[model samples]
Target chain A: MPDERSADEHLLAERLIQALNLEHLAVGELSPTAALFGHESGGLGLDSIDALEIALMVQKHYGVTLRSEDPDTIAALTSLRSLSAYVLAQRKQ
Target chain B: MPDRAHVINLCAGRLAFMLGFVAAGLRGQTTLLPHSLAARQLEAIRAAYPDCHVLDDSCKSDLQWQDSPRNASLDVDEQATAAILFTSGSTGVPQPHPCTWGSLAALGRLDAQRLTGSRQMNLVVTVPSQHMYGLQTSVLLQLFGDCSVHDGKPFFPADVAAALRAVPAPRALITTPHHLRSCLDAGVALPPLDMVLSATAPLAAELAEKAELLWQTTLLEIYGSTEAGTIGTRRTTSGEPWQLLPGARLDCTADGAVYHASHLPAPLALTDVLDPVSSGSFRLVGRAADQVKIAGKRASLAELNRLLLQVPGVIDGVVFVPENGSRTAALVVAPHLAAAQIVGELAQSMDPAFLPRPVVLLERLPRNELGKLTHTALQEAIR
Candidate 1:
């Protein structure tokens, strides 16, 4: 399969794997559009603790804070593609 | 419909769970609270109780509702088994402990008197209702203590803050140390709360002090287990011993302690090592060997290691919580399988929170000649 992730998404994916300590998952193996949370979905199967780690990493790396109460923030965290776009957009601001 | 002896209540929402509880109670059936909703655990529960019915949020009843008199009285059998709460035992299997209606009601009333002085309070709980702590504070308290609980189980710091804001005054946040730390780290704005209840694991004095200072509220930590309901409470920041609830007493044994409560059907021998300071208060020393608590969930490290070794292509492995670490870590000597593959296999039987983070693959563990791993050797290997 062709790699669908953009340059920004690829960078964010590497950071996520390192920050979350996902040693088993390679950046190339990660599907950018797949679900980021939930066990049933064919995704990373991360939990709330990982979510906190991701939030803290995003804040430190891109100066972007993801609030759970914000629907936009939750939506942005749905997948790597969306999270990359959200972080890049926030960084540009 | 054929009658069943028990009903597995898997409702995620508080209201739906309460409704399921009441329906099962009215039918004279015991509610089975599984330790987790994981497929493997649920399968074990089903295998044990072949005649039990499973109920969840997606379950719909075809029966039409019939209006009853407003003042109709409901009779309850206090001696009947109300719920069988499953806790992860040291042996790795989920052990079921039955709670009678009388005991559950008594627990609720005792907790209410001790925590809220029987006052009407709104509760915003972050823990799931399946857990004993969540069931006692959120469901039982509401049923017998005249309190109300928010239906949604709000997770995340911002969501928890929003939930607290949505509720009125005299609100209590029933959560764990992990969740409390997240909320504090996020530094989200929260409304004034009457009290904050922490349980499932020990709360640090510094974190409790920070919460008390920031929220200007009393931060009370509960000491109890699934076997014994709410046993004691203490103001975490005060560095004080836990004050046992009324009608609860501890009898120290050679190994550990035995907990007796008015709500319990029988005395339960506790796995926690305790030091008695007074007649009604005790200081927690530590837990017995093999038990590890992470993110409010308790599991046996020995059992986890056994499960790790049981994974396919896993020749040898050991799971341990690194010194001063929050999550468990593992060192495996599986040359054929990757770290993620081993974790994925273990995830089938274990809770997600207990899964080892940063699983390190090595050629072999630093085991001694007797094939026994020491703490120092394991720590050195992980490092």
Candidate 2:
């Protein structure tokens, strides 16, 4: 069978790119360990609204429930790798 | 007892005036306005209703203005009518829209069901308290939604983060597109947001998505005018026809123009150009009155000028028509930017007739506290 979790992560990455109109941003530019939000130079600046929008989209499409009260939501969305890893974990759950 | 039916509306009055309205048999319904009216405006209204008590927003200074939390004692009919506030006129005047407690209350019911699913809401309003959007979403809806209203205005994103951090959980944000955009620019960590509601100026879809992703909340945009109260709301990216509130209508005439009606007082004829999707919904295309007649060519000066403002390095800009029938002149406010260079860039977006020739440069345009511009004020800058 296909690597379902990896496929889901790619699908989500595509959705985020489309949502943000980041067509100029290539898939390779988005590494597993690339920063999603941080003070680092060249980091993709995802503001709070973008964070919320991504969380909502994840919930709406993948059946992942992101509670405002979640302990890991802020941490899980910190980087491309973390988010993909979190989504994979969520799929298992 | 003057039947209470003849009185059109009642709003947030001082504790004393609140008593007078009840004592005189007026239904004391609260509409969302700033905590009070300025002393002069209140005095004029007092003259109009000598028997009715007048609540004045008479603070000694800005320091006092920031400290007051207006509470009222009147137990008027919760369903009584209230005043309508219009967008402040571009002519340096303000417009008032009339609404009723019954109509606003109905909206609260719809919002509460959609938002809270029957639980009470705790609201943290980020917009100024006076405007129609604030009144409907922050104040009146607070009462009808069974929400506890906070007494503060959070401007900077840091301030907003701090307030949300301190407030009780399950807090919702009531704010404007301007304020919301500023927050996103600041890169602050937001406290939990159950629901985020924004109105006043239009909120772009990208920004709305950003907001939802950051807070893990649904960001809903409200569509209505000061005249229409709140007709309907829609999701930012849904692109669906607006679902009208329980009782609302958009009447179209032969000329393809739209008029508005609701459980509101007297029919409101709008200056907008809209394509009605159904009896209840329409897609608004620029306002008809916003069209400028330049040498017999009809053009949207607002959009044209807005494009000028977006030019790289341009901070704030506006093009006001010369009331004396001269061509439209542009006035710009920027930091050490050249007026001549901006005109060169604006040439790409505007026709020669619509182009602002001999652009007037100022460090800042003279706008009122609300950031609204006027033709007269722009003219004064050029002169």
Interface RMSD of each: 2.4, 14.9
DockQ of 2: 0.02
Candidate 2 segments exceeding 4 Å error: A1-93, B1-81, B84-87, B114-118, B254-262, B278-280, B287-383
* Leading candidate by TM-score: 1
Instruction: Give candidate 2's error at residue B143 in angstroms.
Output: 1.8
lDDT by residue (tens digit), candidate 2, B184-256:
7656688788888876555678889898987788887776665565656777767776666555677767565
RMSD in angstroms between candidate 2 and the native structure over all alpha carbons: 16.6
Q: Pick the candidate with the highest DockQ.
A: 1
Residue B145 error, candidate 2, Å? 1.8
Model 1: per-residue Cα lDDT over B20-73, one tens digit each: 777788789999998777667789899999989988876534332243211223
Local distance difference test, candidate 1: 0.83
